[model samples]
Target chain A: MSATEEQVDHIKQAVERWNAGPVAKLLAKFPEQRAKFVTASDRQVERLYAPEAATIDRYAEKLGLPGEYPFTRGVQPTMYRGRFWTMRQYAGFATAEESNQRYRYLLEQGTTGLSVAFDLPTQIGYDSDDPMAAGEVGKVGVAIDSLADMETLLDGIPLDRISTSMTINATAAVLLAMYIAVGEKQGVPPEKLNGTIQNDILKEYIARGTYRFPPGPSLRLISDIFAYCTEKVPNFNTISISGYHIREAGSTAAQEIGFTLADAICYVDTALQAGLKVDDFAPRLAFFFAAHSDLFEEAAKFRAARRLYARIMKERFGAVNPKSLMLRFHTQTGGVTLTAQQPDNNVVRVTIQALAAVLGGTQSLHTNSKDEAMALPTEESVTVALRTQQLIAYESGVTNTVDPLAGSFYVEKLTDDLEVEAEGIIKLIDARGGMVAAIEQGFVQKQIEESAYRYGQSIDNGERVIVGVNKFTGDEPPTINLFEVPESTTQRQLDKLRGVRASRDVARVEAALAAVKQAAVGSENLMPPILAAVRAYATVGEICSTLAGVFGEFSESTN
Target chain B: MNAAVKPRILIGKPGLDGHDRGAKYVAQILRDAGFEVIYTGIRRSPEQIVDTAVQEDVAAIGLSLLSGAHLALFTRVLELLHDRGADDIVVFGGGTIPPKDIPRLKEMGVAEVFTPGTPARQIVAAIDDCLLHHSVM
Candidate 1:
């Protein structure tokens, strides 16, 4: 064995002794504790483990290096060694102007990329002045009403230089159109623009609730974007199949992988069924996951997901390109793990979680602010969150090597366990006639619900200890700075929207809307007409309302 | 204490946050602890929540939120319950509620603000106590 392997083995033995010593003794004394250790899927588990048997072989065979099928080690061959993961910081609040400043601020901070957070109105495809948008227009995220807002949001930031990620769904096409319009104004060609639109709507139905139309219409829009982006802007990732929201909503690491992959496969099936080749679009498909407090579990989950996805793409879809099989994902630290009780503790939690994401080999990461449990992270807090990642990359030795935990007995075992459990779920999802059918029947939602409930029960029963929450109670609470949207900013945005409306050719926008409606009803793709509307400076609300009229809204079925 | 009388609770999201992690986790624990849990998926308005509570006849309503709009959302739901004549249903909440807002939530007729790390059994027992005391179930 190499010296590194010898050291890994030595550490593994010590860990085994430690687990058997205290943990085993504890388990022996408390027979009831065994039940708590077991996951919802009932995997044989101890609180901690040593790398051996099932895990080591799996790691060596699967997670060896990148550019290989079943890419368990890293997605790209050189990983950060070739190019560092995109330092995409999630930003945006209130008006486009304020959000513009924040975007510029982040860019100046050496942020490799920008991720936009849209308000509820924009997320659900409503104008800032709409009745449904009252009190919510600029509360959570930036309110993008039209091409005007998009222009202001990307004001000084050159489209050619920086890749932007917008966290929008439901009205993702409308937002993407506005972005494309902005790129056109900036003298950047459609093909020159590179970014991602988080157009994952299935998760909206299952977890997030930002959906405007029902599942049928939602899938149509997603597939349309996939088909459109494939032809128009091949570099753009049309959809970022998200497990982050699902995991944040209280799923186990395994459930996150299972449900997320299920969601991705559903999208792929939709696109292929819509008449796109598997390899043509699969390479640009990206994923988003949550990095929680469980370091090894989170790392293992990533490796297992990559391996499982590669196998699925190769074996199921018969994809020939190795890139098509690679599971390139973005991760954000779990917002659910942050606590408002002892707000300061969240910083430490986010740091640890960010470390896990780095160790797990995420393509990009966004660390949650400490005050996120209370409100949208303040500018200072958000900066701290960014610095947390910067610190990990610069100061921590973790980023120096690929899959640093590769040979660890415990990590390997956990990876194997996660794979077995997640694969079992994927099989069940397949057996149930794929993810869409499973979602319609509440199978995926039901599993996530059960896992979430059990985790809550554990914390309640003292089996799982959330520091400064269930245990480690604090007496003195620290005062925190909170971010708030000014009502005046909303008014300013409304006025700017009005000015755009007054200047833009009204007849042209009407024509554009008519074209979008026609395309939506017909078998034609919506992106081109949507782009036409965007070029005509059609308002986001108007475009969405037209679609809503045709596609109708989604009313979720109850339990 | 009869085996036939399993404690039933309705865990739900009463607004547009779309985050159901806490609600789901709590529901799972209550199920393992032997309770019937009905989880209504995300974007449930205040009126819908009260209506679901009355129809399901749950002992308590566990509202979950991660979005900072809990104060506005939870209060509106409580007010809706009062309007709908279902104010008798025990209402408690769990999520990323700040310490400052806990007292406010209580004042707004929330029985408890079960913040992070509060044991699931404790929440379950609290519901049982509320149901027994109010004689609602």
Candidate 2:
């Protein structure tokens, strides 16, 4: 993608003619809108992007055809043309029954997949009745205490017909086990089940503070799930290495890409060290990312990530499987970019970011509602968010072709720059002894914090314009109904948890818990015992506590 | 606030949510504004936050909660402060709190509530103004 001598001369003559004529004339009359224009990541946008900007030696090698190695253009040869990206909305709050209703409603509304949001307690493996779960139960997402709760959560949903993505990390194994058990009850074998688990824990240590066990046992648990799922549940994505949380916590676009893949490398290395073949488990590995408002940067971020990851798997790990080289990912519109000042403006913002994700060729997508800046979105807002995706898919016509923005000079330059910049970041993290050691040494945190602080300073100094906040200010009170979880949700969940505890066989639960403890003590795959305990109706708190006894909990420096 | 005293403040995260960007930013700004700030990080209980405010002998406490559990968590923190005989410690807050809930939170002894997008200068000025009125001495 380089400029030939004739093409360079053509652009040079045309630019010189314009600059000397109309450009100078306009400059004397009126200046540009701002002194400088920058992208969301603060990269200066060139006034003119030409062929020289994209100087590729061989397009076939560097930017290969879709579905080939170095898939800079796209992962799928026929992306949304064959089938539109799966529209999965992340929704869950209150009790299992309530969340089930939401899921059914979403399915009825034509949502292709389900993404469950677990409450803080459920995420950290605390049952509803635990002391630490007092006020937080069901506040953020649905509270699933045991298999009973999971069963109710999936009440009438056809497991074989739909795919589900669970945003669970520290207790991903237990949650996945519960999901498998639910499939079993529905007469659908584990191999027939299709879904993904946010089984990534390194991102938890680096960005989100939701880790239960330390890194040693955490990676062991991850590899165990990897091996288990490969053998039993072939359709499920074993781990979704997430950059969404990292970007939400205020890392720049390149940092988000670098840190996420760094963590992925750590996981792959750990799985290899555990004596698993690269092709055996690498194909099931998926990624999750955030699509911010920067149009080309966000899109290029996805492209760069795919190319970089393809290289890593093929070159670094010697992965032979074609599926293993494809960096399949799900994307969500950036939550941090939503403004609380003019909440309705978020719809436009989300629309833009969602378009970026689609144009970048996401496998699955979630668009945030307008009201998320102030509260969990109401059903009305959720509908609007879903419709936004439908508009992009059907009405917008971007899905007519794969990688619609692939060959644009600006986009190709951005893709290359992002790849180089993110590779530099990865090299730095590798020098720090990989992601785990970097997170432990607080190097990654410090970098993110500094970026966040600078971003704040920019917004404060009006270097960046947040509509309805720094510019076009308004004080209008929000008339949109804020989605509120019932104050009694905690009590209702506690009651359900207590009833399950009372009705379940006490001795059976105890034996299952003891078996989990034994597995944790030894080098056994913790999945079987954990699944048994989950199926036996032992609470999440019980299983996590049993594991905690063997593997100590993680507490951050919290500086 | 006596300009000489450099009024101490504790910014506590009082919920299961670990979104600490706001809490951390506010703490950094307050510290830069010459207030001695103590940040008890994420997943802090009401009891832990109240005990830290009392133990640190801070003149004010700023609680940040984004999990929509602010109503329950803030009430409990205020109750604990009262129970610990530390009610004089001014407690302000911030997070994803709605405007309608601001009055309710203030009525619960929360001195002020800063929602998302509040500027650093405004937060520091408000804290300084509140500490001046609710003097530690």
Question: Residue by residue across A1-559, what tens digits does model 2's lDDT show?
Answer: 3356567669878988888899889988998888898888878887777765234446776788888888877888888999999999999999999999999999989899999999999999888888888788898899999999999999999899899999999999999999999999999999999999999999887777778999999999999999999999999999999999999888999999999999999999999999999999999999999999998899999999999999999989999999999999999999999888879899999999999999888999999999987888888899999999999999999999888898788888898888888989999999999888999999998888778887888898899999888889976766778988987888888888889988999999999999999999999899999999998999899999999999998887765
All models, DockQ values?
0.41, 0.69
In angstroms, give how far residue A116 of model 1 lies from its true place.
0.8
What is the CA-based DockQ of model 2?
Answer: 0.69
Docking class of 1: acceptable
- Regions of model 1 farther than 4 Å from truth: A1-61, A498-503, B1-12, B24-40, B47-63, B74-94, B101-114, B121-137
TM-score of 1: 0.87
Best-fitting candidate, measured by lDDT? 2
**Candidate 1 lDDT, tens digit per residue, A1-559?**
7555676689778888887787678768776533645533334566565545434444456666665767788887777667767888898888888999998888888789999999888899888777656556776789888888888889988998899898999999999988888998999987988999999999988888798998888898888888888888778988899999888666788888988888888888888899899989899999999998877778888988999998889888898888788899999998878887778889999998998898889999998998887777788988889899899988887888788888676677778779878888888999999887888898887877766766665666666677888888878865877776675866887888888889999999999999999998987988899999988888888999999999988877875
Alpha-carbon runs more than 4 Å astray in model 2: A1-6, A9-29, A53-56, B1-4
**TM-scores for candidates 1 onward, in order:** 0.87, 0.97
Model 1 chain A scores worst on lDDT over the 10 consecutive residues at A33-42
